[model samples]
Target chain A: MAQIRMETNLLGANDMLAAKNRRIFKARGLLVINLMSSPGSGKTTLLEKTIEALRGRIELGVIEGDLYTDQDAMRIENKGVEVVQINTEGTCHLDAGMIEKAWSRLEHLPIQLLFIENVGNLVCPAEFDLGEDIRVVVLSTTEGHDKVLKYPLVFQQAQVVVLNKIDLLPYTDFDLNAFNRDLQLVNPQIRVFQLSGRTGEGLAQWTEWLVEEVGKRVI
Target chain B: MHEMSLIAEMMNMVRESAAHNNITRISRIKLVVGKLTMAMPHSLRFAFHTMARDGLFQGTELLIEEREVAYQCCQCGEKYLPDMPYGQLCPNCGSKASHLLSGRELFVEYYEGDSGKGEENGANTHGN
Candidate 1:
């Protein structure tokens, strides 16, 4: 028997769909963001705050990925943005095909930005690309500094790292300097925004950065 | 786990390639897994063993190779191996290089299987 040489990516099918989604997004001049983080990292709250900040500056739509209910989708809908909820049942992450289906609902909404809030898991979500223009990983200050080092794969791919719940830093042992150093090791050029979803401290910097990113891609 | 789904795809690939190349039974399969991925070998093996019980793929030997993460220096334009397994520091120029040369891969490399022209022992699909 001879050895057949074939280099086949296991995620090739999903990646093909992701490429198609990217092309579709580009043709429509829309920017999609895949927001990821661990459970209890306050990603929903961060999105709420972000939606409030960019209400009039840029039109927004969201596709919320969760295992069970449409809780986050409801939260996003309360912010006056069109939202779609995808229940993965028990899947740990969201794939490009899910986004492809979700986009159909918001296809004619005249929105400029789409946020795919991936299921709250650090490991699996990083493995799949959902045809997003930007990837952001939200890590709250209470999660500790070792998260950047432990979950390097997720942090490395993120263009922006959101350090939320800074207002609670006083009660937690989370070290910002150490966290930055770890993040630098993973990705030296990662843009970091230290903010609080509850107190709104440092929200302006994050919102300004978001607006700038949208402005850069809006055609 | 995602590995389960990925392994299912790998099995499909093996079958399709076998049917295309006129092979009946695949005996050995080789896969290259990256260091940055969260796939544990045991999990993949379990998934493979459990799924290979089907008629298309049975008792297939799976070989997995773990790859190390490498980074390319942006300053000196050189690719140097880092001291540790997962850091992005450029060992050559000591710069904060953003280009990741390797270590985000998960793919099937090679496989050996039963071809046609013999006594047609389970390889009759080849139609020799």
Candidate 2:
């Protein structure tokens, strides 16, 4: 009985820290997005294309979370945007404390849009809150249509779902209508976009929606 | 995996609680995980069993309580749990304005432990 009370108190502490981080982000008037997807789902590719599309419009900064290496961070930096790499040292997801540390390195940058690319895992990353304005999940058609159903938590928690690699839909047996139906079943209100990062087809709608969302936050 | 880290966090919480309460051993642990968390109960149990070894909760039994997703309709101000996945329309008022109220929590609710052993009969009690 007493032990349970104490455990509750401990989680309370962590939740309080999460709330504090959220409050800080809200005060800054910055739009923070926690981007999550499976490995090789074109997360970095989509990000690159987004940067190119919205570069002049939005002042963007990125915080890349990975198990090891600064490869993703380097990729984002090559786009001439401010980026921070947080190597989790084998940890699967980025928690509030890790984001807090990364924020210190990015606090000085004149950033309006902050994107945190979470480690490539569908399950664990959805569990942690990193003080983001939205939680966006990316799914590539090459990964199969069953992804949304298999990992319902990510889709359920996400505010937006980006279906990348649509160019390969003809080569693969990926079903767009079925995928959208499953996504709607899990999260009806979630905004989903179908696009091919390689061909730059169907990306404009997503970027335009993102620009509008950022605009609303900026004003 | 992230389950390992979460188990480590759970162990720390158990240890801190046992120490604070001056309890020696944790007999059982109770945790509530929301369905939306999507944590595999088996995986979490496996992780906890492996990580809890040689710790304060060496022989503790982890009891996990699962909760379903519930939402409150923002328009009609009605609270209800949806059975179908992605059913945004309220059953009563047919309002699409609904917001998630719970089902994302992952926390250790409490633990049970024996305080001390009795002198003669060796029965568990609050103190020796």
Error (Å) of candidate 2 at residue B119 is 9.7
TM-score of chain B of each: 0.81, 0.80
- Per-candidate TM-score, first chain only? 0.97, 0.94
> Candidate 1's residue-wise lDDT over A1-219, tens digit each?
656777888899899999999999988888899999999999999889889989888899999999999989999999999999999998888999999999999998988889999999888899999999999999998889998888889988899998999999999999888888888888888998989989999999988887887788777
- Give the DockQ (2 decimals) of all models: 0.45, 0.33
Error of 1 at B15 (Å): 2.7
TM-score of each: 0.91, 0.84
**Displacement of the residue A163 alpha carbon in candidate 1, Å:** 0.2
lDDT of residue A188 for candidate 1: 80
Q: By summed lDDT, which 10 consecutive residues of candidate 1 chain A come out lowest? A: A1-10
Q: What lDDT score belongs to each candidate, Candidate 1 first? A: 0.86, 0.80
